[model samples]
Target chain A: MVTVTLNGLSVDLRDRAVLHGISATLRPGELTGIIGPNGAGKSTLVRALLGLIPATRGAVEIDGHDIARMTPKALARLVSYLPQGQALHWPLSVERLVALGRLPGLGPMSRLGADDLAAVHAAMKRADVLHLAGRTATELSGGERARVMLARALAVGAPGLVADEPLAALDPGHQIDVMELLAAEANSGALVVTVLHDLTMAARYCKRLLLVDRGMLVAQGSPQEVLTSDRLRAVYGVTGRIEFGGGSAMVVPLERV
Target chain B: MPEIPVLRARNRALIPLLLLGIALVAIASLMLGAVPIPTARLLDAALGHGDPVVRAILLELRLPRTLVALMVGGMLGLAGAALQGYLRNPLAEPSVLGASNSAALGAVAAIYFGIGDYSPAVLPVLSILAALASLALLFVLAGRAEGPLALILAGIAVSTLAGAGISLALNLSPNPFAAMEIMAWLLGSIENRAMDHVWIALPCIVGGAALLLWDGRALDALSLGEDGARSLGVDLARTRARLLLGVAIGVGGAVAVSGSVGFVGLIVPHLVRPLTDRSPSAVLLPSFLGGAALLTGADILVRLIPTAGELKLGVVTAFLGVPVFLVHLLKERRLW
Candidate 1:
């Protein structure tokens, strides 16, 4: 198992700081939810973690190895990322799209071997997109496309998976389906960190939550500790009630108060 | 996934077919020029056993032109596939995006100012420099945007600016004959071109094509967007830089030798896209072969057209390519 640690990470883009002094440790064995309002720098934090952009200060480390120093391929072997909106350049079939995930494992002249193909198959099956493998990713519904892209990320089989708003365009059913998939991945010993907007799903499914607002981490703890009524109102500007049912917490937004 | 096994087998067989087609077209181009050589005599001339006149025509005249056509067309197609894949835009190409025109503008200026009269090398070197400048201009105008519209707009801007530059140079020419000469050069022709032009362009084209082919896997990963691809081990900045340099060298070399041959790159990749897997990386080699076949075929057809002065190769390609391009545009009208 791998552990991702962010120590006082600050990112400045074109004279403007998007994330400021953010610190957190994301560990394996739990699905950690990063929830924030729009423009809370959630995506920026995730990008910094993946080493897509350099941090302005401090560092992100995977098992004490600084991410900034790692090659893109090396980081990819340790962590897989799913961006917010899936961009499909061609009308590639689902299998080929997912097979792209195994790129780090293969060399330039190497063809996909039995093990790589099997990993892809397993990832597709886990994402519940095995039936859609023959379909073109461009032609799929938004929800179905999300799952296919998720499968592509999972096909990497990296120890750490970081996704930005994976459930943004999904229906409630697909949301749960995706949440269960991430949870299963976590249970299977991969660290899964997803940025979620739906607090109810985040509370019910995410074992830990990192709450951010205005470019800073407002709070981070278990669902019961982080999703309190005062925190919701202060951060989201909504008066909400948290309910406990069937051993899960659900947040019901009362009104914009 | 099950269908992929069969498709792979089909594509594996089709690669050789494409190569064979290119070979046939190359041979046909050699055989069907003005004053056609009989097959027996052509083979004799090819192997150094024919009349001196036949040998000169085959070896000195046709051979260089044929080689230039093959390299120029293949380079265009390969560069087109590479650009399209990098920008994630289907419409990206050397000529359409004004890179060729920019190179031509530079070469035309050189000829107008009498630099080309001093040495043949001056023209291509200046043209290559100009092509690189145009790409740099395109990046500056488009900024960090990654969509088709931004790139297309930037390309059009660069193209129009270069066209204006060419026109201004022609208008300011001291002699009227120079104007006509510049005009003919701009029209692009392989006729009367010697081995010198071939030697000038071939090395750069081959190097650029090799560099482009090396990035096939990275291009595939890039379909996942910048962040996703980077997270998948792709070095986005480095890849973009290499693509820019590769296209500059390849397309620059072609334009330096042949002037601005339009639309072969755009048309060939689109035509070949359906036959192969839709991956941009997979289409690079086929596009190269298809481009060679298309240009070689066009070059030969230009010889057979019976025009008073042989039709310019650029004019021929535009005449054949623009309508096909329009049809593609209409088919994808919803995108606009």
Candidate 2:
């Protein structure tokens, strides 16, 4: 029911332009993977859209309003985001971490209500972290922590999610589980966008792809339409194969010389 | 009655904190003093009682210092908790940003140049101004950096420079006795302090602590990185500025009157965290009371150990603080 539009967005960090005039649209009910090499301005693009850093030349819009104009709680209720690496401040329980998702819905003077509790319980169930709800987050394995963070994000129940490298530290099992979860979210109507380095997972799960080289959006289409070996080699300096059938597709990238 | 996990956890922490805080305040104000004023005697004197001398000692000498130490301790604790919460670093103290050293230098400047002797108000003013300056400098330096550690490191550097400046002021003094007095004062001893000192810092400490408490939610958002916090609707610039101002002035006022009291901020926050469900807001008032308890106890310890020739409150804190900090380091093995 809603969409995100990035228009001529530019970003600078450490006095250098990291994301340059790159534009993309994220549609509803689809898992759009923003794929690229390391330091390809993928995260920068997300940060720029969230109005974290000042855009040099353009703007990002959610639901047809400029993102910068949206209030923080409003934006959070609409679109949730996760960073590449998030460290914990304390050894909070999984449920406590998930409850922070309801912060946007909470008023300044108001405390959490019954709906908040139900939402937190539902999110924990959805992320499959229900068993770990009472356990300390720090005691969990890396994959478990990732799942809890995902649960926290899903707890927001936003219309759109922009997660940067949510699967980086996950095990192979968790990786697929998280991908399937994202796919399920999209299937259920939320627009889930993720920046993934795993070409295999990206190809298998995402409904659409946006490939970038440096700061430019090099290609955008379905898995069969894009993610070709030639484009992969050009952008990533590597070669890859794409296999499609049985309602699934996979891309395996070969080593570069 | 809310049984949500976060609510339950917070509830578990809050009850003990309330009891312990009240107990600490009671023992601090009533029992731990040089004259050993019993609760009954204190109550009678507080109620305008029978013995004139008991009433006078309780009302005049012990009461002012106790209230000042309590207030100053509370301020440092709150300041420390706020700065630590703001940066999400456990090691941050009120003195981290060179505010204490800057205030000490200001106090030394006032004393050395005879400005403090000129007007009763000149001393705290000089200390506050220099502290605010150091805070501004810290902002300029840290604002240019990416990581929070960089800002803390910058604050350490500023602290060292201000410390050296204070040393230079001592060395340049013409009167050796006065120089030594200023030096000892700068080392932070709360002895022979009068009602005048209390009047000077009480308003500033009270006001600054209120400012720090007002931003509890802002501190919570900052737990999310600037980017994530922004998306959640925190105005980063305004939040950072207000906290910095609060930390700087609160610390400056306390240190100006009490000399350079340290570790109250560090120790209080650490001790209060486990008691506050690790919630920054819950930690705020408890940290303040905890700091007051610790520092006032240290002051009382200083008075009790006459054979040690009246040790400085700072020395007692350092002696206790270093061991506690080391134990924490051994346990956590990581920064907050």
Candidate 3:
């Protein structure tokens, strides 16, 4: 299992501070959702955590190893990332696209071995894109593409998975399917961190939620603790009603505060 | 799924077939020059039993020309595929990206200043330096700009500036002979190129090609775009550095010898892409082989076309490349 530790993380983009000093310990075997409004530095936080972007004034440690000291391939073998709204530049087949996730594990001259193929097949089966393997990724429907991209991420077979807005542009049904898959992934004993926009979905699926507002972590706890009406009004600038029922929380924003 | 294996088998067969084609074309190139040698005589020459005149012609003249064509063409195609893959833009090629022109300008400067008269190495060295400068300029101008249009615009600007430099050198030449030499080189050809040219260019081209080929996996990852690729642990900075240096060296060596041959790089990859899986990495080796065949074939055509003066190899490539490029632009305007 992996534990991600953010130590006084701050990110400055072009001299403007986007993420202020924040620290949190994210444990594995849980689905943790980062929920925030637009321009809330949610994406930046994830990028910095994955070492895609350098932290301006802090350090990120994965299981006590400083991320800055780890090579990209080393970090990638530990955590797989799926960024939002990816554009396919080539008409690569779904199988080929998914196989790219194994890049971190393979050497420069090595071909995909049997184990790699098995991982690809397993990931495709898990993401329910096994049937679409022969088809071109560019021609797939929005929902199909989303799952294919997810399968690509899953093919990494890393201990930690960080996905940014995987539900964006997906239909409600597809959204539910994706959430179920992520939850299953967490249940299987992997760290699953997702940046989500749907509060109700986040509350229902994620075991823990980190509420970010203007680059600061306002609350970090169970959905009921973080989704309080006062915090919603102050951070989201909306008056929302949240009801806990059937072992889950349902959140609905009535109107702008 | 059955079709997948069949398709893969077909793709797998392409490289061997291309090699065979290059061999055939090289022989045809050897046999059918200004003074055509019959196959029997060509074979005899190969076995060292032919007439000494025929042997000299085969070994001295056509062999160097054919080797130069293959090397220059292969470098161009490889560099083109690498650039297109790195930028994720199909329009990126050595000439289109201003690499060839800048290298050509450097060679012209070398010749104009009489440094080339001192040694054959001076030309390619200066040209490689200029190509590196152009690539650096290209990154500074279009590196962060969004969309394919920005890169194309930056390339055009670089090409125009390099073209102006070449023109200024030509316009202020110390003698008419220097000006004429500069003009002929600008048109681009492999005619009368000796083993010296091949030796001068081969090392740089091979080194550059190695650098380009080394990053095939990284190029494949780049299909996901910068952020996604980075997330997958592809080092963008290192990949970009390799691409720039590779293209610069390859284009520099090519233009130093062949004098700014254009469109071979652009055309070969397009032709080879459909036969492969269409991954950026998959397109590379085939493009190189196809490019070698194309230039050798074009050089053969240069001999057979019955012109009062032999047509320059660069001019023929432009003639062959423009229509294909236009068709691509018309059919895939959205790609730009």
Candidate 4:
């Protein structure tokens, strides 16, 4: 299991600060939801965590190793990332697309081995895209594409999985399906983190929530402690109430504040 | 998921077929010319046992020309596949992106200024430098943008600028013969080339093609777009640098010897892509072989055609490439 820690992490893009000095510790074997309003620097934070962008200050550590000093291949072997609104540029087969996730583990001249193929098969099965293995990825529907991308990420077999807005184009049923998959992954002893916009899903599915607004970490706790109506009004500009149903909390927005 | 055995088998068969086509075309290239040799005599000459004249023509003249055509064509095709995969654009190629034209401009400058009289090496070295310059400009203009339109526009700017430079050199010639020489060279031909030209181009072409084919896996990961590929451990800045240097060295070496051959790069990948699994990596090797076959076959046709003067190889490739390119534009209009 891997533990990700952020110590006073700040990010600047194009000479403008997008994320302030924020610190948090995220543990494995739990699904943590990062919730924030639009343009709240959620994407920037995730990118910084993966070392896709340089941090203006401070550092991100995984299992006590600073990611700043880690090679891209080493970092990728530990953490898998799924970005938002990915567009397919080629007509690759689904199986081949998923097999690309094994790139971090592959040598420059090595072909895919039996272990790599097995990982691809398991990822496709888990993401429920096994039937689409032979289909061209570019021709799939948006929902099918989302799940296929999820399979591609899963094929990495990294201990930590970070997905940015995985459910944006998904239908409600597929949203629940994706959340359940992340929850199952966490239960199977992986660290699963998702940047979510849906408060209800975040509350119901995630074990803990990190709430941010305007680049600041406003709150971080369980669904009951972090989803307070007053905090929602102050941060999201929406008046909302947390309702208990079936042993979990769900946030329902009443009106714009 | 179970493997699709039929599809897998078909994909595996394509490489051998392509290699067979290249070999047959190479042999035909050796046999057919202004003076045709019978098959039995050709084989005898190949074994160094035929008439001296036949042996000289086969071993010295035809062999070097055939080798140059194959290497130049293979370089074009491999570079095209690599560029298209890296940029995620179907239309990306060395000529279209101005690397070939810039190299041609450099070669023309060397010839026009009489610097080529000093050494045969001056032409290729200067052409490679110029190709490197144009590729640097290409990345400066189009690298940060996300869409194909930006890259295409940048390519147009570079190509037009290089064309203008070439025209300027042609307009102000020292003599009529110099003007004629520039015009003929610009038409792109592999005729009358010797083994010296082959040796000059071979090292750079082989090295550049190695750099391109080495990035096959990185190209496959780039199908996920830049961010996704980066997250998967592809070093984007490094990949870009390697592609630029590779295309420059390869195209510069080719243009140094063959002049401004256009459209072979653009055409071969499109023809070979459908036969593979359609992944960027799967398209590289077949495209290389297909390119070799296409150019060798085209050279043989130029010899066979009954025109008073031999047709230029560039003209033939343009005729073959434009219609296919237009068809792609009409069919995949939504891609941009």
Candidate 5:
């Protein structure tokens, strides 16, 4: 597992500043959620960390080294990241699309080796998609596609993962299943940062919640400590009830204030 | 969601049909020609055989022409397949970059100035150089953002201007026979070509095809879109340069010898699509084989069609391809 540290991060997207001077240290083995309403720069912040978008005023260090100079394949192997929109290519079988995750480890002229196959099967199993391996990604339902996307990420088997809105279209059952998958990864000591719109899933699954508004972190703490009703009203402009029930605290978004 | 069994079965069935079509074309190519060479004599000639006249006719003329047709067709087919896969645009072909027109202009320039007759060897050299240079210029003009259609328009513009220049050059030529000569070359008949012409184009075509084969994985990534390919570590600039160079060498050399034959590249790939399991790699080699077969068959048809005069190979391919092109155009319009 590796830590990700963003220092004085500022991002300009096509001449507009999307992220402004945001800084955070993400700990290892933590299922951290970057929770915010739309246009809060959740996606921008993550994109910045991946070094996909150049940070205008700052830099990011992965485990104390600059990410600026790493080769693309090496960076991919070390840190797997999923952006907001999933790429839809050929309507390939789930097994084949997931196998694309093994590309960094394999050379151009080489076929998928035994280790690659095993890891793919394991990753698909981890994402609860073992049964759907033979199915085409395009043919799957939205939630099923989300899980398959998660499985593609899992197939990367990186030390850390940063996924944006991974649960946006998932149904409640798959949402819980996917959250459990993330929690399991963190429990196994991989740093997993997920950007989520569903506060309830974020509250129940992630150990740490980084709440942001207007490109700045408003709160960073445990779900119960950070997801207060007052915080929700101030940051998201929504009314919400944060109550401890059934052994876990749930942040239920009541209504827009 | 459960359209699985049907699609799988269709993919499988298409492969056999494509194979059968290719085989039938190949057999017909060997049998139907000017001499009416029987199968036994054909086999004997192929085996380097008994009658000196039959052996000479088969080995010297028929064999080389058939082989040239196959290779040229293969080159066009594979080139077209690679271009379409790279751009993800169905209309993409090597000619979209003006390689054919540039080659024609180079050959015409050589003939008009009496330079080709001065050194017979200089014609192909001039054609290859001009074609390669035009592709390089196109690479610069289009950059990465221009897709297949953009390339086509740029090529059309270049070709039209070059064609007008050819007309003027031919008109001003002192040799009265120059106009008829240029017209015949422009009409694109693969007649009186021998093993020497085949040898001239073989190395360039094969080398260019090797580069195209290197582009397979990258083309697969490009199907995801440019940004997607970049994310996967594809160096866009290098791939573009390689792609253009391959097109220039293979296509320019082809037009150098055959004089602007159209649609082998376009027709062969589309025809072979059924055999490739809908995979890019499957399309690549099969298109080559299928293209070779189609052109050879067309060449055989040119030989056998019993006209008062000989037929043009280009005319036959165009006749075969026009209906297919129109069908694709109509089908594509309805698809969208």
Candidate 6:
């Protein structure tokens, strides 16, 4: 089983502290949603977890190995990351774009074989962008590009997947569809952590929620515990109304506190 | 699924054609110089069986010039592709960004100081060192935030600084003859070069190109951008460092031999990029071949043009390259 642990992790950017004394644990088969408002260090936390940034204090450990000590190649085999925006410079075909995720698995001189191609195909199917395989990634619409980027991340088939705002440019329907895809990925045994802005969707699909505000982890637990009206009012300055149906939780934010 | 393999196969098939093109152009360049050598005699001279005069002309003159042309062209093209791929900017090239000029300045400094008269090897060594130093300074000044405008601006600044330095050296030279020597070298040419020049440049070019070609896979990963590529286990800093040193050595060697031949690097890659799979790694080798062909062809064109004192190769490239650059700028006008 894969487990990612953050021991009092903190980050300093340009001498300004962005994340401070944040501790969390992500386990296999758990889809964790990180929710925070603007300037709340959500992206920074995700970047640190991916080892894209150095933690100023403590450490981020994956399966008991300090992430900083692992080689990039070794770390890549365990963690797959998808950044927020879809920034494609070249007009590579959609299939080629997804195949980039297979780089870690392939050797320097080794070409893709049946297993790698199968992973690419499976990722495309999972992200529902198989029809756009021949299309140029740069020409795709916002929602389509989001799906294609997701396909790229999924092609890694790593033990842990982290995405920053995967649903940003997507419409409501695609948003729900992507959320379902992420949930399915978690169920398949990867520890999925996503930075999300949609509180209702996070409550619905995420098995655990981590709330951050002003660089500190304010609360962490199930949706019913972390999405409490008191914490929502205090941290987000909005009153949250929670309801349960069919064993799923939905949250509606009332007027600002 | 069918289209992906088909496209890849087509791209792979283009490599041999590019090699063939380079061979044809090299032959044409060797044959079409000041005194045309007949085909049979050219072959005999190539095999060291001709009259001493003909063999001297063939081996001592034409072959070196042609080889230098091919290598410089290939170097320019390869450097352009590597820089463009690494920076993710289509406008990145040694010449356009003033890297070649910086190298030229270094070589000219060697001549002005009379170190070049001591040994031919000193020129390229100094030039390559200058190219690396200038580029390092550029990265330090610009930092990692490579917006299109920021990169172009930084290139302009470096180019201007190198140009000013060149002017200062010329003005300070004690002898008018030394100044003239610097000026001729600055104009750039593949004419009158011997086997010695080829020997001096060959090693640096090969080493630099090997370094660049080795980073091909990493360059492909970089098409995903810094964060994405890094996340995929590609070390961005190391890849960029390797690329800069590679370009510096290759461009520096080209400048020392040919004296600032610009735009082959910039134009050839743009010309051949459409034929590839839109991956940086795929673009590199083809760009190298296309460059060799273009420079060899351009060298032949200048010879056939019947110009007064022959048009400088650098001038021919600038006249052709600048317009294409302008067209690209026009298309990317929104960057302004």
List model 3 lDDT by residue over A114-148, tens digit each: 78878888898999998898888888999999999
Stretches of model 3 off by over 4 angstroms after superposition: B1-10, B118-121, B133-158, B174-177, B326-336
Please give the interface root mean square deviation for model 6, in Å: 3.2
Candidate 5 residue pairs that clash: none
Task: List per-prediction Cα lDDT, in the order shown.
Answer: 0.86, 0.79, 0.87, 0.87, 0.75, 0.84
In the order shown, the candidates' DockQ scores are 0.57, 0.44, 0.51, 0.57, 0.19, 0.52
List candidate 2 segments past 4 Å from native: A107-110, B1-3, B9-28, B144-146, B279-281, B328-336
Taking the tens digit of each residue's C-alpha lDDT, what string does model 6 give over B1-336? 423452346466789999999888888877887789889988998887977888888888888999999999999899899888877888778765567889989998998889987876788778878887778877876657534455567768888999999999999988999998898788778888888889878987998888888787777777877778878988766776677678777887888789988778887777787787777887888988888888888888878888777688988887877887678657645422
lDDT of 4 at B285: 84
lDDT of 4 by residue, A1-257 (tens): 99999999999989988999989999988899999999999999999999998889989999888999999999999999999986678988888888889999997656887788888889999999989988888888888889899999999999999999999988999898899999999989999999999999999999999998888898998887889989889998898878967856679888998
Candidate 5's displacement at residue A14, Å, is: 4.5
On a 0 to 1 TM-score scale, where does candidate 5 land against the true structure? 0.81
User: What value does the lDDT take at residue B49 in candidate 4?
Assistant: 98
RMSD after CA superposition, every candidate: 2.4, 2.6, 2.5, 2.3, 4.9, 2.7
Q: Candidate 3, fnat value?
A: 0.57
Please rank every candidate by lDDT, starting with the best.
Answer: 3, 4, 1, 6, 2, 5
Tens digit of per-residue lDDT, candidate 3, span B1-336:
122232234366898999999999999999997799999999999998969999999999999999999999999988889888877878778777788889999999998999998987788789888988998998999887544567678888999999999999999999999999898888889998789889988988998898898888888888987777777788877787677678878888888889978889988888788777878988888888898999999889888898887689989999988898778667755433
Worst 10 residues of 2 chain B by lDDT: B1-10
Total clashing pairs for each candidate: 0, 1, 0, 0, 0, 0
- Per-residue alpha-carbon lDDT of model 2 for A1-257, expressed as tens digits? 56989888887787897887877888989899989999898888777776777788788988779977877778888888776776666566678777777777875535677888888888888899888887777678899988888888888878888788988978899999899888998999998899999988888898999987788888889877778888888888887777888666778877894
Tens digit of per-residue lDDT, candidate 4, span B108-205: 89888989889777877788778888988999998776545676788789889988999999899889888888888898999988888889899889
Cα lDDT tens digits, model 5, B1-336, are: 222222234344544665576666665665667677788987887787778888887778766676678778878888899887876767777687778888888998998888998765577778888888787767666755534456666667766766777788788877779887887788776777787778878887898888777766667656545544544555667777788788889888888778878888887777666444344544776777677778877888888787876678888899989898778657535322
Query: Which scores better on TM-score, 1 or 4?
Result: 4
DockQ of 2: 0.44
Candidate 5 residue runs with Cα over 4 Å from true position: A13-17, A36-41, A54-57, A130-135, A210-221, A224-257, B1-32, B38-56, B111-114, B144-189, B308-310, B322-336
TM-score of chain B in each prediction: 0.91, 0.89, 0.89, 0.91, 0.86, 0.88
